[model samples]
Target chain A: KDDTKKEIMKYYWTSLHTTLANYPSLPTLHERNTLYHYVISSASLFPCGDCSIVSQKLMRKYPPQIGSRKSALTWGCKIHRKFNEEFNLTVPTCDDIAASYIIGS
Target chain B: KDDTKKEIMKYYWTSLHTTLANYPSLPTLHERNTLYHYVISSASLFPCGDCSIVSQKLMRKYPPQIGSRKSALTWGCKIHRKFNEEFNLTVPTCDDIAASYIIGS
Candidate 1:
């Protein structure tokens, strides 16, 4: 269950970053807030209770940094690493995370 | 890009359904709302603009039906099929959806 939740989180966050990159311009306020809610609500809805607890704590601590695509992607990668640390899982470097989600140049 | 968006949507929605099935009890109002936002914001954040437009229309037509796990799963499946139909993709039956996400049962 923990591993499954982790996989879901990885996919969802990667998708978010890739989506941000796919857009031609900076996200509008509405889009930024929508992305914020996606991360927060997804954390809250994590199936693993322990993982959700950790996620919620991290949500409060780091929050979501949203604005341009690159900023959002960077923020997501950083937070994902934080979650990895919290779970004691193998942590990916920021460069690796960014590379994994690259949609365009 | 369209195919990538479709695959992301498929993974995210199926994850939601599977997570619902993993939970032992009905979700609280907070949890339900969280799940709803996850779906909405995900649609809003879809990489493909055309897909996002179609997803928003679907959101308006079918607001999330939240209460129990099974209900949420059913609603997600129905909406996903609606999306499939809208996109002219292969549509999975509701039964097939439930079967795919089955946890304990």
Candidate 2:
């Protein structure tokens, strides 16, 4: 079961990576960081902070570090569970972004 | 007091209008609408659904309709206040997006 979840995170990240690859100038890390902070500062955004929807997508497709591979999955789970407090929406974990959803294109 | 609030909404719309001027290919209403629905399905996103962060930003800058100018202000507030349940974040009314935050970039 966990393996399936991890696989999904992978796909999600992969898709994000593909989308961002087209952009010649990736927003600076600072800009991204600022944006992330802005989104997460709010309770809704913050719960999803540990893992950004975009970051999870980016990492699975193009991991900056090997360690991120697992972090993507793990961190994503944390955010999903956190947000599920009320809405019961399926939380997006890092792995869900990477391999599963990020499937090439 | 209401006038001040309305003025603030006006400024927000203006800022959104400015940012949109740069987008050569604006996302179609359908596409934008899809994305908006995706984000808002959850309670967090929905509260902000009445006023999409990007839409509020877009409308204030480039209006498809004059009627939307006012909708931007009203809807934004509904979403902002809705999310304040656990996270006392300032509600982002439509006006916040159009005239205030949308100030020319």
Candidate 3:
């Protein structure tokens, strides 16, 4: 179960980052709002109940930053850093995040 | 650009299927609504503009089915079948969708 959860999360996070990385550098207000809704909805509807709960709480504390592509990417990395800290995983630098998650960077 | 788009879409579809497969068999109204929002938001926000536009049109024609896990899975498979047909790819039966996408079935 734990392994399955990890694999699922891996795909989920990768897809999310890919979307953010490909976002327009200067998104329209509507686009920004749409992405914000997507992030919050994911927190509520993520497949893993425990993870969803955690994400919900975290989102309440620090909502998604969707003003621009760079801001969105940084926000995603920040939330991921928190998750990594909680799990005692290697913490990624912003550069590492860009290099790893952003395609054709 | 095309190859990158394909790779990104692969991850997006895998993550979406994983989420749907793991959705509660019988979800609350709120859960159902959340998933619907996620689907529509995904159609709007997917990184590939052309694909997102196509999905938006498809969604308008045949909205998501979120009543139950089974229904949701079937709806997802049906949409995928349409995309496959458009791309001249192999079509998957419902059983094939279950076998391939649903984990630990």
Enumerate the candidates' DockQ scores in order: 0.51, 0.03, 0.69
Which structure among the candidates has the greatest TM-score?
A: 3
Q: What is the descending TM-score order?
A: 3, 1, 2
Please tell me which predicted candidate would have the highest lDDT against the true structure: 3
lDDT of 2 at B34: 32
Q: Which prediction has the highest DockQ against the true structure?
A: 3
List the per-model TM-score of the A chain: 0.75, 0.27, 0.87
Q: Can you write out model 1's per-residue Cα lDDT over B1-105, one digit (the tens) per residue?
A: 556665666655555576666543577778778777887887777666777888789889998777776777777788879988988988989888777644323
Give the native contact fraction of candidate 3. 0.73
User: Model 1 off-target regions past 4 Å?
Assistant: A1-6, A22-25, A101-105, B1-6, B22-25, B99-105
lDDT of each: 0.71, 0.34, 0.79
Q: Residue A2 deviation, candidate 1, in Å?
A: 6.1
Give the Å shift of residue A14 in candidate 2.
12
TM-score (chain A only) of candidate 3:
0.87
For model 3, residues A1-105, the per-residue Cα lDDT tens digits are 878777666766776787888777999988887898888888887777777877788788878999898889889888877766766778888778777776555
Sort by DockQ, best first. Answer: 3, 1, 2
Supply candidate 2's per-residue lDDT for A61.
47
Per-prediction TM-score = 0.83, 0.24, 0.91
Candidate 3 per-residue lDDT, tens place, B11-105, comes to 66666776788777999999898899888888888788877887788888889999988888888888877766766768888778767765445
How well is each residue in A1-105 modelled by candidate 2, as lDDT tens digits?
444333333333332232222212444454344333322322222112223444344434443321232333344345444533333546655555444333232
